[model samples]
Target: MKQSRLPHRFGKERGRNKMDKFMDNPWFVRIVAMALALLLFLSIQDLGNKSEGSRPNGMESNEVETITAVPLEKYYDSENLVVTGMPDTIEVTIEGQRRFVEATKRQRDFTVYVDLSDLSIGNHRVPILYKDFSEKLKVKVEPVYVEVSIQEKVTQEFPVEPEFNNNILAEGFEAEQPIVEPNRVRITGGKETLEKISYVKASIDAKGLIEETIKRDTKVTVLDRDLNKLDVFVDPEYVTVTVPVNNPRKTVPIKIKQVGSPPDGTVIKRMEGDIEEVMIFGWTDNLQSVNEIEVEVDVSEVTKDVELDVPIKRPEGINKITPERVKVKIVTDKAKNAETNLSEVPIESKGLADSLDVEFLSPVDGAVSIKVVGNKDELKKAQEGDFEVFMNMQGLRVGDHEVNLEVKGPKDIKWELSTEKAKVRLKEKGTV
Candidate 1:
C-alpha cells in the first residue's frame, strides 16, 4: 500500500508542480487575474443594483416646505367678461426629495390659477390649479378652490374731476378751476359696477402751502356716490393736474384808532396818519369783507403836537398789510376845548348769545349820556349817531355780570362815559 501511495503522491506532486509552473507564466497570470477582476466587477454591479432596487424608484429621502402668499391668476375673456371674488393669493406646500424641495422653494417659479374660460356670466365654484413647477414635487395648496363671479364687461367714458386740499393753499392764495390734461377718463368694469360709478377724480399732489401754479402727475381713482372705492381700470392711469393758485390783492383805507385819554384840559384837534391807504393781499373771498384796516394809537401822555411811529396789526383773514408801521401826527391843545353832552345814547348789543336776552341792570333804560370834547365848535356837530357804545358779551353766560363799556366815535373827539362799567343780567330767551 505504501508503494502504491508513493507513486500516486509522486504523480500528485508532479501535477502540482505543473500547476505552479502554469501559475508563474505571465500570460496565464494575466488571464487568471482578468477572470477574477471580471467576477469582482460583476459581483459589485449586482450588489449595486440590489441596493438601488431596495430604494423606491431610486428616490432619496423626502422633505417638505410651505410657500405662502402665492398669487392666484384667472383665465377669462377679459374684453367681455369681468370676474370677481377670487382670492389674491394662496399658500402652497410641496413635498419631494430634499434637493428638489429646496430648489422649488428657492425658485418659486410657479403659477396658481383658476380656469374661467369655459364658464359663462355667472358664479361658479372651481378648483385652484398650478403649473410651471417641477413634476417631481408633490405640491399641495392651502386653498384648493375659489368661488368667482362672472359678468358682462362694460366700459364708459367719465369726466375726471380734480380734487385739491384747500388747506394747503397759502394764507393769501386761492385755487382756481383745476385743469386736467385729459379731462375725461375711460373706465372699464362690470356693467353693474360701471352703473354705480359716481366719481373719477385725480388728487393733486400738494407738498406744502402752494404759492404758485403747479402741475403734478397724479393717479386716477374711481368711487361711488357714497365715496366708497370701486374697483376698475382706468386708461391713462395717470394724468397731469394743473393747479392755478391766485393771490388776490386789494387797496383799502387805514383808520388810526385812538385809545386812552389825553392830558387834562387837552383835546385832540386833528389826528392824521401818513398811511391813508394800504395794499392788502389775501384770498378774494376774504378781501370782499374788508374795507379798512385799523391801527391803535395811544395818546395818554401826549401833551402837544407830535409825530410818532405806530405798528400795524393785521386783522383776521388779512394775509399781509403793507407798510407794517406808519407815522401819525397828533395835534392837541387846550384852546376851544370844551365838553358837551350827547344825550340818550341807546345801547347796542354785541356778540350776544342767540338763545339769550340781556338787560342792563344798572342803567335800566339801556341809555347813557356821554360828554364829547373837541374843538368846541366840532363838539356841537357831534350827535348820538356819531357814537356807538356796547359791551363784549362773547363769553358771558346766564348770570349777573359787570362788564366794561366800549365806545366807537369820531377820531378827533374824546368821549367820557357816564359809567365805565354797566351791570347786566343774561337770561335765556322766552323766560321771565
Candidate 2:
C-alpha cells in the first residue's frame, strides 16, 4: 500500500512540474500576447469600416450649384405686336442630391422663359418661369418678374435717305448724291409712333475713309419732324448706299467755238459765252490740263441776234461737270468793209533763249501798226488789244537776222501787217 501511494504522489508532482514549465516558457507567453493583440486590432478595424460604409438614419448627400447668365426665351405674338422691357438672361441656383446636382450642372438641363401669349396690349408684369429640370434639383432665378410693354402694329411707308458726318470727310473731297437701294422702306410700329415718323435714314461713319464709294450694311433709323430719333421697326433694315467721292476740282472759263460760217451776206458781229465759268471734277493730273470748257455754236443761217443752248463737251478723264449746258449769244450783221488802225500793238519776241538778248531793229517804237477789216458793228468793238503779233527767233545765233511776224485775230476778220518781217539782233545778255 505504501509503494502505490508513493507512485501516485510522483505522478501528481510530474504533472504539476509540466504545467509550470509551460507557463514559464517565453515563446509561448509571447505567442499568446501576439494573438490577443491581433484579435483586438481586427475588431477595431471592422467597426471603422462599418462606420464609413453607412450613414446616420434619414441622412443623404446633397450638393449646391450655381449657373450664371442663363438665357431667357420669349413667347408672344411677335407678328402683330412688339414687346419691350424684358431681361435677356438670368442666373439660376440649384440644390439637390450630389448625382442629380452634378448632372444638372454638366448638362444645364433647364429652360428659362417668360410667357406673354395670354397678355394683352399695354404694360403688364409677367413672372419669369423655368422648367425641364430634374425633380431633385432646386432652381432659383435672379429676376423673378419682368415688366413688358406691348404696342399695336401699324405700317407706313417712308423715303429712305442717307446720313453721315460731313465734317469727317477728307479735305478737298466731296460726296455726290447718295443713292440708297430700295429708295423706300416700310415701317411697322404703334399708331402714335407712325404718326411721329418724319423720315427714315441710314447712318454711316465716314471716318478714315479713302474709298471712292462707301458700301456697308447700315441700320435704318426713323426720325420725327424735329429731327429727334424715333423707335420703330423697319422692314428691310439695311440698304446699300453708294456715295461717289472725288477730289479733282477746277473752276474755268467757257470758250465758244464756231462750227459753221455765217450766212452769205451776213457776218458774225460778236460771239460771247453766256456762262463765264464752270466747275469741273476729275483726276488731279487730268484737272491740271483743263483750263476751260468749250462749246460749239452754229451760225450758218443766223442774220440777227440769237441765243442758243449748247451742250458742254466733256473731256477725257473728267468725271463730272456742273451746268450740263451753256448758253451762247451770237450777233450778226450785213457784211461791210471797215478798217481799224492801231498804234500800240506791241511786237513780242518769242522763242528766244534765256541766255540771249533780243532787240527789235525795224519797229522804232517797239510796236507795230495792225489794220483789221470786218463788219462795221464788229470793227467798232475790236481794238488793238485783240491782236497779238509775235516774231519767231527760235534758233537764231548772236547776229542780226530778219524774222517773219505772225498775226492772230478772229476768223471772220481780215488783218494786214505794216511789215511782214521784223529785223532783230541777238547778243549775249550781259555783253550788250
Output the TM-score of candidate 1. 0.64
Worst 10 residues of 1 by lDDT: 1-10
Q: Which runs of model 1 end up more than 4 angstroms from their true locations?
A: 1-54, 57-61, 167-173, 205-214, 264-269, 283-285, 303-305, 331-432
Cα RMSDs of all predictions? 11.5, 16.4
User: Among these predicted structures, which one has the highest TM-score?
Assistant: 1
lDDT by residue (49-125, candidate 1, tens digit) is 99986877346778889999888999999988998788889999998878788988888888899989999888899
Give the C-alpha miss distance for residue 305 in model 1, angstroms: 4.8
What tens digits encode model 2's per-residue C-alpha lDDT throughout 1-432? Answer: 565456788999999999999989999999999999999999999999998668653277778788888998999888888776777788888987787888887898689999999988998998899999987677888888988877777898889988866666564466777778877888888766787887788887756745366777788888899988876778898887777776778898888888887865687778887788999877677889999877888887788889888889888877678888888888877777678787668889888999999887887666788888777766887877778899887888899898888988776677888888888888999995
Regions more than 4 Å wrong, model 2: 1-65, 190-199, 209-211, 223-232, 251-432
Error of 2 at 66 (Å): 3.8
Whole-model Cα lDDT per candidate?
0.87, 0.81
